[model samples]
Target: MNIIEKHLAKAADLEKVSVGEDIRCKVRLVVAHDVTGPMAVEQFAKIKIEEVFDPQRVVMVIDHIYPASTVQARNMHWILKDFTKRYGTILYEHGQGVVHQIISENHAQNYGDIIIGADSHTCTAGGYGVIGIGVGSTEVAAAMATGTIDLEVPEVVEVNLTGSFKPFVTAKDLVLTLIGRFGTDGLTDKAILFTGPGVRGLSKDERMTVSNMGIEMGAMISFFADEDKDEGVAQTVAIELSEIIPVVACPYSPANIKPVQEVAGTEVTQVVAGSCTNGRLSDMKAIAEVLRGKHIHPDVNMIVIPASARVYEEMEKHDYCKVIRDAGAVLLNPGCGPCFGAHQGLAADRDVVVSTTNRNFPGRMGSREAKIYLASPVTAAKAAVHGRFVDPREPSGGGEN
Candidate 1:
């Protein structure tokens, strides 16, 4: 059995699921963000479900709409707050950070444990070796009440990775390259089992980037193997990390990818360096390494959001805040900033923005008329200072400097 199968089988032994040819498992935890939690809470109300099975197992984060964008948003936040208190569910209030980041910190993945979230990128929790899957608000509600949900045993695909990434190439770049090859709908409903030396070699933080974007290709779940034990899954695709180049998902889609060199020097109006996908301390250190003592371009509007309050404190400890803020970047309290264009910064019509966020679909960054580019934090950091796409491996992109 492959890793996914082994996980499901083990979960079946827990009360989470009963193992049969037809397997449906109980979710270990149910996580929701502000943007999606309200509906789930409303669903819980509709079902007349007043009490959660275990409040400690549910997490609600208010990251998407920071500081409450409007009166309606504020009211919704209050409703969520009330819900958390009334039911005893864990609640991370507005400005705490993105859902995925907080989940990673608090819910360390357990082997074979199944966790799900309302947000698609909840698969990101797989970085810690859990079977993290994303479901809708209704499913989240059900999990909150019963701690169980049915899952389609995904057809697992083995992504055998070889070689290693070089200087300036990152997990984001490799995932982007995979999306470029597989297209946006590439992994549709399939769980990608990452294996091989490449998978084992990646640090936990880097693995998060890959698992985070698993949904970008429409993946059901993306995770690395704990051991070389094969789960009898026949399908496999191998990726050579050494062959990947820094890539950007051009505007209007996450899979419309091109190598950075292919679009190098393309002008950008705004550059953002933060998101659940790329807002960790490792990411911050990478961005600051390139931006040390250098100022961002006058034409560029840059915002750097740490993934969590914890990440923010680490930045202060390392003086990364000084290095980045002094370089003219807006340092916002940890939350999902402008990644979805909720607040903090929004692009103007016809503007081109490069960001570290996972998605780049139409109007994803506020204006439908504006374009968004997706890249690694390092690439985004370089673009912020240069005001255009530049190869970070090039001399002008601070590759050697």
Candidate 2:
């Protein structure tokens, strides 16, 4: 059995599991944020159960609209707080960071653990070699009610990598390259197991960046494996890491990918460098490297958000916050505010933004008239400096790595 099967087998307490097989497995953790947690708590109430299946295994986060953007949001937060308080489940409040990053850093402790989140980007835990599944609030309610959930084992797609990445060619670039090759729905209902020697070079944060975008390509999960195997594999896609360059997902779809050079000089009004995808300490360091001792373009507004309080502390220790502020960028607290378009630095009409977030759909960050280009932190930082798209590997506009 491969990695996915191994996890399923362990969770099911079965000797083996097969692709397409239906099984009920014990879940190690169930996560939901402010947006989804209230709905799930409401659903769980319908089950008529007095207590959650296991309070320790459940976590609720207040991230998407931290500080409550509206009366409705405030009430929703109240629901989550009341539910967790009544059920004794863990609650992560405002400034804790995005749910996915919180889970990866705090709850996901063991390899091959079966983790579930209400948001699709939960696959971010795949960086820890865990089977992270993104399901709806109803599924979360069921999982919370019984401590178990049903699943159809998915086929595995092996992303075989060769060679090493060039400077400024990050894991975000690699995943964008994969999405470009596979199209948005090409890997629907499948799992991706990254393999080959090149995987050895990537850091845990980089792996999380790659896995976080797996949902964009319709993958069930994306994770790293010790080695490549043909048994129980559905297909294999090979990638040459050295050949990859910084790329972006154009507005309207993650699949609308183009090399950064192809879009050079396209004016951007805003730049963002944080999310569950690329809002780690290393990502901050990368952005700081580009903006240090230099100010961003006078016309552009750059918003830098750290993913969590812990990452924020690390950035402060390293003086990354000072570097970013000196570069004329605005710093916001850790949360899912701007990335989800709920609050904080929302793009105005006709705004063009270069961001490090995972998605680029219309109105994702603000007005439908706004356009967003999704790129790595390095690429986003470069755009902030020049107020336009510029290849991060080139010689102009602090592009040199």
Candidate 3:
């Protein structure tokens, strides 16, 4: 059995399992956030259950649309607060951080643990060597009530990564390159198992960046395997990290990838560097490295957001946040800033944005008429300073140095 099968079998108390087989398995953790938690709580109420299956295993995060921008969002927070109070479930309130980041910092400690969340980026936990699956609010509610989830074992697509990343090239570029090779839905309903010598090249946070965007390719889950598997996979694709350059996903699709050179000089109205995708301390350092001793372009509005409060504190201790702010970037509270297009940094029609967030779908960051280019933290920071996309590796890329 492969890594997926091995974990599933252990969770299901079975000796063996097969791809495409339906099974119910116990989960170590279940997560929901403000955007989905309200809906999940609504569904849980429908189940007529008095308490959650295991309060310790259930977590609710009020990060997305946090601080209550509207009455409706505030009411949603009230729902989650009321639910958590009644059921004794753990809740990370406002200013805590993004849901996936919170989970990674707090709950994803053990390998081979089964984790499910209502948000697609829940796959971010896979960086911890756990099986992290994203599901709908209904499914999350069911999992909360029953402490188990039924799933059809997905066919595995092995991503064999080799080589090391070049300077200014990062996991975001690698994942974008993969999405470019295989269209958005190329791996629909499949599980992507990362393997090969290249897996060792990425730090845990870099691995999280890779896993966070797997859902953009329509993968059910994307995780790093503890060991290499030579068989039982539906397909295998190799990625040479050394050959990858800074790239971006063009408007309306995460798979519409292009080299930064191709899009250089395209004016951008906003630049964002925060999300489950690249909002870690390393990402902040990348942004600060470019912004230090220079302010962003007068035409560009830059927003820097940390992934968690702890990350924010570390940034302050390291002076990354101070340098970023001194460079004319607006530092917002740690949360899902402008990633879901719910609020904060909404682009106007005809606006162009370069962001470190995952997904570039129409209206993903604001108006459908606005164009969003998804890139790495370094690329996004360079764009903010240049007021357009520029190759970070080139001395002639032309930005305020």
Tens digits of per-residue lDDT, candidate 1, 1-401, equal: 56687678666553332213566677788999888999999999887866898999999999888788789878778878999989999999957788888988876656767898999998887777888899999999888888887776677878888889989999999888888878888789888888887787788889998899999999988887766535566587878888888889998898899889988989998888888899999999999988998999999988899999999999999989999988999898888888887788988897899999898887887889899999999999999889888998998888996
RMSD of each: 2.1, 1.1, 1.4
Put down candidate 2 lDDT per residue, 234-347, tens digits, no spaces: 888788899998899998889999999999999989999999999999999999999989899988999999999899999999989999999999999898759878889888
Q: In model 3, how large is the Cα lDDT of residue 398? A: 38
Cα shift from native, residue 73, model 1 (Å): 1.1
| Per-model lDDT | 0.86, 0.89, 0.89
1-401: candidate 3 lDDT, tens digit per residue: 77877888899989988988999999999999998999999999999978888999999999998888899999989999999899999999867899998988887457888999999989888777888899999999999999999988889899988889988889999999999987899988888899989898799889999999999899988889867545778888888889998899998899999999998889998998999999999999888889888889999999989999989999999989889989999999999988889888898897898999998888887788999999999999988888888888888653334
Clashing pairs in 3: none
Pairs that collide in candidate 2 are none
Question: What are the runs in model 1 whose C-alpha is more than 4 Å off?
Answer: 14-22
> Which of the two candidates, 1 or 2, achieves a greater lDDT against the reference?
2
Q: lDDT (0-100) at residue 80 of candidate 2?
A: 90
| lDDT of the structure predicted as candidate 1 | 0.86
Worst lDDT run of 10 residues, candidate 1, spans 12-21
